[model samples]
Target chain A: MAHFEKASSITEWLDQRLAITTVKKVMALEYWIPKNINFLWAMGMVLAFTFALLTISGIFLLMYYQPNVDTAFDSVNYTIMSEVGFGWLWRHIHGVAASVVFLIIYIHMFTGIYYGSYKKGREMIWLSGMLLFVVFSAEAFSGYMLPWGQMSYWAGMVITNLFEGFSPDIAGGIMNAPGLVEWIRGDYVPGQAFLSRFFMLHVLLLPLVIIGLIGLHFAALRIPHVNNQDGEEFDYHEAAKLYKEGKTKESKVIPFQPVFLSKDVFVLGVYLIFFFYLVFYHFNFAMDPVNFDPADGLKTPAHIYPEWYFLWSYEILRPFPKDPGLIAFGFAQVAFFLLPFLDKSDTVAPANRRGLFKYWFWIMIVDMIVLTVMGKLPPQGIWNHIGLVAAVVFIALFVSLPWVTKNENRA
Target chain B: MKNELKILGVVVIFTAILYWGVEPFAHTQMHKHVDGEHFAYSDLNESTKKGNVENGKTLVMGAGACTGCHGIQAVAHKAPMDAATAVSAYGVNPPDLSTAGGLYSEKFLANLIENPAHALKVEHKFDAAKGKMHPMPAFYGAGGDKAQEIADMVAFLKSIAPKEISPKNAYLDACGRCHANRYGKLDQLGETPTFKSETDTLKHKVAVLEYQDKLKAYMGKLPPDLSIIIRARSEHFLETFVENPQSQLEGTSMPRVGLSAEGFEKVKAYLTQTGDPSKTAREAIGPWVLLFTLVFTVLAYLWKKSMWKDH
Candidate 1:
């Protein structure tokens, strides 16, 4: 939070001109982070690294990837896999990184919630992150559609058709475009226009939004020092005081560089090794095999599941009818933003936080995992009931947070 | 959050050890039963011992199971009864062998003729009628000149009726046995194929489903259409694997019909035509992929170290 240190002449000059010192103090090497916050704090750094990797790999893939319905699958199979040198490597990295990045983000989000980083001062962080999650999901769905494979085709059909509830044709055709779904798709079914639009959204439009949001998210995070596990030193006044004074020996918080940067870089190295293992050794682990076949609207696969990261939500999507399910899904994320407000727990540290919150928190985690597993199975027979129950419990965990906080005793 | 960095470091070390540990195990486990002594196509001397197609046509017409279940060229007094009535008497319903030559590899056919259950990897479960477990009896040594006769049979199948003779050939060569070929245009069964779309493949599925009696006659255990089988089994395993059931999978009832080494080659040629014909190309491309990955890993490691040094 140090704006100026009266150190270097170049820095001083830049500060006089454009307040580079202020910028540096806010987010750069001069930014101060809590020294006690360990590797758990590095989750954001890890996510940023993976996002950069995904973006780079995705750019390389975009160079050769054809977003035409006719050539999409073949372009991936022949041009990308065989014709272009190391194109397969880049494609694998992009696809695997896309799935892996969600995993890292979920863990990162969990860490945010586990500590009370999302509470009060950091509510904007949670809201922006949730918005980013929705945008990224849209990006993923669009990217998936660009492939024009079987799952991609059906997924495009199923998700796009959710908009049918709002379409004039579904109602009584009172006003606008009678076939809005067909108009958006540009055909009776998913075809060239769908691929083109999805490609544009996946590569161009959504990334800009994500980049903008990330800037704001990081900026917001900088204002509030990271919450530690045992959470004690939470003082906005102290942060302002430290910002006024360049150096503080008494405060335990350290600068971003040297202390945190080394640990972040080290964790990133380990993460990359696992990344390569998935890309090289388990290339098809995250993908559905039916994607190899080209799209045929006449035929559908026996089971159609979204990527695993979306499984928990997809599980929630089951058991209810489409219209309400869509609304439920929308409300679910909207409810997520209210979590910080719902959690009326006193202490910032989960360790000292009294009540049934810790137990409830664990139940939600296990519930999500259970729902994820159930999503992969067919939504029939016993699974219908399981999904219904899990979905109820999932919503209950978040919705009843305020009530749970009121009723529960101190831990 | 406390001692978590040390925990992460320890996890990384263990992961690295585990990562390095898995390569050799993967290499060994990739093809677990790669028996060295097994016969390959290279072992057979096909030049001097060319399979006589003429002799094969004769054996196929007159052989015990050949004439009984299979009708190759012509003259088959339809088995006194279809498989259903016969299964009651013999506990097995044999499949039509019109496309047998194209469906099975020469080695597979030879092994099957010599030792049916062993070749097909099944057991002689006498109680089960018209079941997969019912034994297929050995046919190679049944006659006076059984060995040579089997070779000729295999040659006839391989050369004359390949699973897919060419992209232009009719798709019927393999599937025509169990499934009927019902094209609206007659005499087009032998005509050149020009499939610009999946409609051609879809037509095959419809034609196969048209034979309700054929499917029902096998009782509950319908032999899966051979159209997809070639894609499932490989050549080398099908070669050394044809003669003995115990060498590979045990407990299944496909009887042996012995064929000589030359006959085995013919069958291998026939079945492999449909299944994994691009195997050589896939194998050729594999090494380059491995090399690229290994080289990039080293480069990534060096770059990672350099990036972290400043941090």
Candidate 2:
């Protein structure tokens, strides 16, 4: 791509010094994405839009949301809902988007799994994306608690209480000191300090970190080049060089602008339709009824269910009583962070190769859905047993992925 | 490629319009309310004045004419005029008030009785059908003498409840009529109580509706589950609201639940406990399932093994 060609005076001035146009020409206009990607490829764009919407809406909501034990619940219920001109819309977007972003990221994760995008050189991309997911979850959980509703207060207490697992009781001797939960909560329970700290993480800290990670994720994806269905690398710079040398057919890449950009926008429009539909029509669809009730430290909601996205791990948290269950819960998330290393198939695509891996992957999805449903269902009777099997299968799928992939038939 | 940018540009503009224009419009369309349109559960403060339960029963049963509409087993006053008859004059049936103190937050109940139409419109987003205001007439006017009468009525309504009624049954009887009960669907190992008479059967039918199914939203507000009301609102505030709600929030539709001070105590306890009826059961289930999952891991490991033959 030729830069500074028939440039306007302003473009020439900027390009002559800062090279702003030059950077855009390289990264934006001339950037090449693989031509043979699907609607799944548009997920990155949807995530970016969701993240942006969350930030924008979150900022507006923060203007109204009072981060105090006294005011947090009502700020959302009254001030945000009735006081602010369009506070309801923004609050709903931020609140509902918490679940939607996770929904998008889950699909994004499954897409990675389906195409094996996490394998080989793209490990950093996968790692950062997984980090985003993990951190994003922390962000959502913290924000969910900020409303200081019954669920928020209880969930905040329940989650912070998970740190109690660190305090091991051996022969009646405690290993870790007490108040680990208090330390995180900044009090005996979720109160003033919990709300303040969560407000910071939800709006500022976690988002900033995620923004940095998303940059790294995009950088890693672009640098080694985008992974595709075939699992073969096609370097855009090399392809560009070949095209300049009249070996254009060998260069199977198109500039991201017109090709990927349009698809991403189209996808963004489609994504926003569903996203705003939740915000507008089904705004409370993802919200639990208990959250509408104000927070009460003395009372815990009968079933301490996390939002739907966290249900997979929450289900995994169940069935392992005490320290063992806590350990299993901790290890469940560790599976995703360890996924790239756990899955070592030389063949990238799970299309035909990864036979056993594919079978188990669907089972994993089914298992996760069951686990999610079980998480919402009161833990009793046959449901508990069903949840138990689902949890075992959940961990088993990840545990056996590497070995299963090794044994799977190759393409 | 040029066409692609055009499409992208169009999409970007379309989504922008949808976000700024369509969504907010739709949201505003559905909900037309002002800031502080309704009070937060926590914002309400309870009155410290001790209510007299004896005074409450006298006000309700003696001169209040409360039995003209509401049914109270404790008072042995089942109004001769049923809902069907009342609809001709009142525009809506006066709901059975047997468990009024039990179901409603005291403050909500107080507001409703003091100003029937206003309380429902504000707190519950209640709308009177056919342009008629709420069926319940305002018993306590703005006159100075009305305070004791209002308090006495609330206290009297409060006195009708069974002490330590299981939170689940309380919800079924009081709140189950309007808000949906998620717990009602849970498979109960316990036996249903047997009702002996025609009146008992009707009450049982209404209770069953609340056992687990959801009620339609009143106006825009989902007649909210009282399961968490105790945790949601303080007992004092709950009772104070029921004593005379219009004093705190004008234009609330919830009729004052005419419960005595003793009745208020019993109902408040019941509403709060419903927040976590299965607390112990849920927590206990966690450990047993964990043990089962560990045992099942062996079976799952074998199942994974069977999926492979050569290796």
Per-residue CA lDDT of candidate 2, range A29-132, in tens? 67877765666778888888888888899889888888988987767766676557767667767878877787678778877877788877788988988888
Kindly list the per-residue Cα lDDT of model 1 for residues B134-224, writing each as its tens digit. 3355664535566776777778666655444332122333322233222211111223245667998667445434343444443333433
How far residue A10's Cα lies from its native spot in candidate 2, in Å, is 1.1
Off by over 4 Å in 1: A1-26, A166-180, A234-250, A321-324, A407-411, B5-148, B151-311
i-RMSD per candidate, Å: 9.0, 18.8
My TM-score estimates for the predictions, one after another, are: 0.63, 0.60
* Candidate whose TM-score is highest: 1
Every model: Cα RMSD to truth: 11.4, 20.2
**Predicted model with the maximum DockQ:** 1
Tens digits of per-residue lDDT for model 2, B1-311 = 46445534744553344233223332343232333222333334343444568876776666546777766765567865653355344433455666776656676566566776554544344454545545566775434356556666777777785455554555444434344433233111122455689798676566544332322222223344454465454444565665555554465545444444545555555554444343344345445544554555455445433432111
Candidate 1 C-alpha lDDT tens digits along A137-170: 8888888886677889998888777665533454
What DockQ, between 0 and 1, does each candidate earn? 0.07, 0.04
